[model samples]
Target: MPRHFRALAVQPKWHAHDFTSAAAFKAWMRSQLEMARPHLTTNQPNLVVLTELNGLPLVLRGGRWATPLGTFQRVAAALFVGRLARTLPLMWREGVSPIRALQLADADANTRLYLHTCRDLAREYGVYLCCGSAPTPRYSLVGGQPRRAPGTLTNQTVILDPQGQLIGVADKVYLTPDEEAGGVDLTPGDLSELRVFPTPVGDLGVAISLDAFRPEVIGRLEEQGCTVLLQPDANGAPWTAKEGLPPDPANLRDQPVAWLESSWTASTRGRSIRYAVNPMVVGNLLDLTFDGQSAITGRAEDAPEPRSYALTSPRPGFLALTPWVTTGTPEHLRRAGRERAAGSGHPLENEYRTDVIWADLTLPATALTPPARTAHEEALSAILGGQASRNPSRVAPGLLAGLGILAYLSWRGLRKR
Candidate 1:
């Protein structure tokens, strides 16, 4: 039987450097959970969501900036450099790697603060909490449990149950250019490492910001029976217009807000999968404008109402989704079947005039009949990919002839010597 419950996506405005004090950071963290608590009120277990790197902002806040930026130009310069070049020498003196610098000072303590705070929220609310992503060097969760690393680091997302037990972890598979500049070197987590976290709502999977852009990652999770793709994101300047470009659309490179949402919608299309809840970061970090388009999308033609819903603002609040389990409509089913029959569902929207998405969703059974690949198709792909093996009988004569020539050359050379 299909299970049902409430799922909340919180897209709060991140105040950079507001939590410079450890005490203040922890207090602010609890308040953020308090903002999300009311939305999760339910007898059934709920799944609470937050954006990627949500905790890292606090970590960064705790660390003092060596160079202060007073003007917009200075901020822009800081964003490009990511301030790592100036800080690397200082970090080395502390006996730590450049990669560890990204998580800032007192890395382990700050990380524990973030984790413990969220765990408390989960236990308090009795909700399954899929906490935000963060870059940490000293700590990691591997194989659904804590894996303490003295040096290694990854951009990881952690999920906890109502009782505050660890459910799963998803490390990012890709990193942005900005992260690389910030000395955030991460080992990408593979498909096998990305496990599905079973919750009261459904089977949950996570794809951190950059991972969400990789379609193959999502497809692999779907193949492994994921019902909802929890996308924790912290994006910078993808929505801003190109400053020096020509007025003509062709001459300039800039995408409209709708265009960005459309691209994200395409990611959830045709898979017959249920929902995609994306909670994104917002506010200015250095000069980086974290775009605040947190959205929740569903399978094509599945929900009768708006399957694609988004929140544009970063105000402290919650966007809740109550999942109503049922079979797809005939029209929706026809489109899905056509996609299955054609061996591909053509990738195929939402509330008007609002940044936040608050709505009910129509979903189906967690398990569905996915389009299976035929042997002939698989063989063709293998052949095209140069993976097909050559026949042993065809190569034996050539191998023997080559060996014979080699032996003859050695014999002649030895005789001449």
Candidate 2:
């Protein structure tokens, strides 16, 4: 009989209060895992995946003054004021701006909290956990303590075994423009360094966010005999808004339709990679907002055509998809966007909710067998041929606005000093 396993995709809402302290963050994470407990099976392996940059909010831990600030600007301002002595010198020494400097100053603490929380959760749940990504400089555990080293910052994902020990780490290779020089200023991981992690369920390949949209990245993983793909994402735009210009010439305005070209389109394209899980983070971080439906996709053996499956309908490829609570329609989503701009909107307008979408999937009889490139690949070639118009550059407006706010605040602080 073929081996079977359960895959859980977590769609978590980001809240500033959750990061009030290490204890609070861990408790929130535990609660999210608890939501998945009912779906797990004792007879098979379980793989739990969270969204990209899920741990990035931990930077606000210990910022009790900023907990009630809610909006990104106010909280950032509070953090900047509270940690001026540390951020100022680090900013000057590292030749970085105040925004990046604040992140760096708390990098070590963020890593410890993020890692320990996920590690403990994996052990408690007895599952293989992909703890999502965190933006931090490279570091190592020295005497069981996280020690930082001088290096470029990268969005890195960690995988922990059921025993609560880390088994894999994959840094994001392809970065969005916002993650480049002008935005968060993160360094991209080398594509050559991508690794396939072995687990009881199957061989796992992790493609963080935009990385999943690249054929080269997917091909490299398939070449290494990967059976399952984990694409943890945090979409920075309205899920119902038009996907921008040019490539979307037909005026294809739906975000979910445009998103299909990545994970759903990849796994069903006649590769050995049989299943994919995409967990998206929803909610806003200051002027920056992320919204998307989390989904699980798979290729069934008896399907008439090579099509991907999702949990929710209206789309064919997804086996399971988490629904948007408040921004389900275009009008409502646009209204929410407007409210965010005016700085007056109900928090639920961003679809801030925690959901878990999971499915029992069959694993390949042998984990090392290479997948054959079939006609399915040829038929679906167009999907991955050209890049979608919805690239990271679209976030420039929000980033610019946030930067302006930071600049004004910094100038005022300097003048007061």
Candidate 3:
């Protein structure tokens, strides 16, 4: 019997400085742990996948006026080093005891440092760590720079066993201009190379967030003997009438499920998430945006509902999953059958097959202590927090002065209505 495992998707609020100043980032990360600890201590999900940090870091190289608008590109470079120093320890201390396997969305030069640290942390926790690097610049010529495409970009999902030795890697095979831009040229990985990582849980496969959106990608993974597909991404943008969602879109719809050409993940036969819709981000409340319902869909034993978890869900939904390595003709036969059946099930893959055992993953909700806001963050958070916080007094003064007023006068009704 396949054991049920509790799994949680965490998208921590991160800024440029977080990784640059490991101490500060660690402290902030520790505080956020309070929000997740209850879930881990209670639900004990066997897997935890953390979202990559997305905010632009402060300027790193050029003069402020000459530099780009996003963030210090260098900060992305520093991320791995910071993770090694601070974040990885937290994983070992908290997640390691309960969460047996962990994954993350990797970005930037710091990714190198982060991977090395993850290797070390895997040892400390006696757990496995898997992370994927972002695609390089997407455009053939980015920011007026050009380079040859590398067969594989740095930071493919580098897998480390409990002893922290490198095992397998899944380089991304698809590329968009954005992924190709900003720095080095990226080479998409071979699609045929996608395979499962034998894990303590089961034969596991991971498709980075956007990777999951491509039915072909997930199909290939499933075809290659993968049982569980873990997709980690950073999503949550303004909704459009054209966008169609509320995510659980069982009834309402332009389409029951949201589909975007640029979505982070898609699968051939099982479930696909339009976006990570957890409300962990501060602006999410006002914008009504969310990322990290980290929604999952697959059939396991016909439960009343396909398994799903909110970041705030109760714990113990996951159990300690031990994947005993098994290799046999039976495994091969199963894989072949799945592969043959894959694309028929969807357009993305030609043929793919796999097995999955499901169980409830209940994670207890913990009190969320919002991370302390720094002065620099006030601007970003204000937009997310709500429009109500905008200075009403300032608006009132301007209104009283009739500043920059544009009014229409009607014959009978000239009111501000």
Per-model C-alpha lDDT, please?
0.52, 0.70, 0.34
- Per-residue CA lDDT of model 2 for 284-310, tens digit only, reads 665577877788887644223332222
TM-score of 1: 0.63
Residues 1-417 of candidate 1 have per-residue lDDT tens digits of 556666667665555455555556667656656766666645555677777887665544433352255333333223223434333443455544343443443444556666666776777778777888777543434553344454455677877787776666677776665554333445555565665655566677788876665667777776677777788877554333332121233454332233233324433462534676776655555444554456666643444343322212222112333221113543453343233221132441011011223334434445533234323223222222232122211101122444444434433332343
- Tell me which residue pairs clash in candidate 1: 311-355, 311-356, 312-355
- What TM-score does candidate 3 reach? 0.46
Off by over 4 Å in 2: 67-70, 140-146, 244-253, 300-315, 326-348, 351-353, 366-417
The worst-scoring run of ten residues by lDDT in candidate 2 lies at 389-398
**Candidate that beats the other on TM-score, 1 or 2, i.e. the better one:** 2
Report the lDDT of model 1 for residue 262. Answer: 30
Instruction: Report the lDDT tens digits of candidate 3 across residue range 12-85.
Output: 54433343333443344444433444454233234444443221121111122322233332233223222233
Candidates sorted by lDDT, descending order?
2, 1, 3
* lDDT, candidate 2, at 267: 74
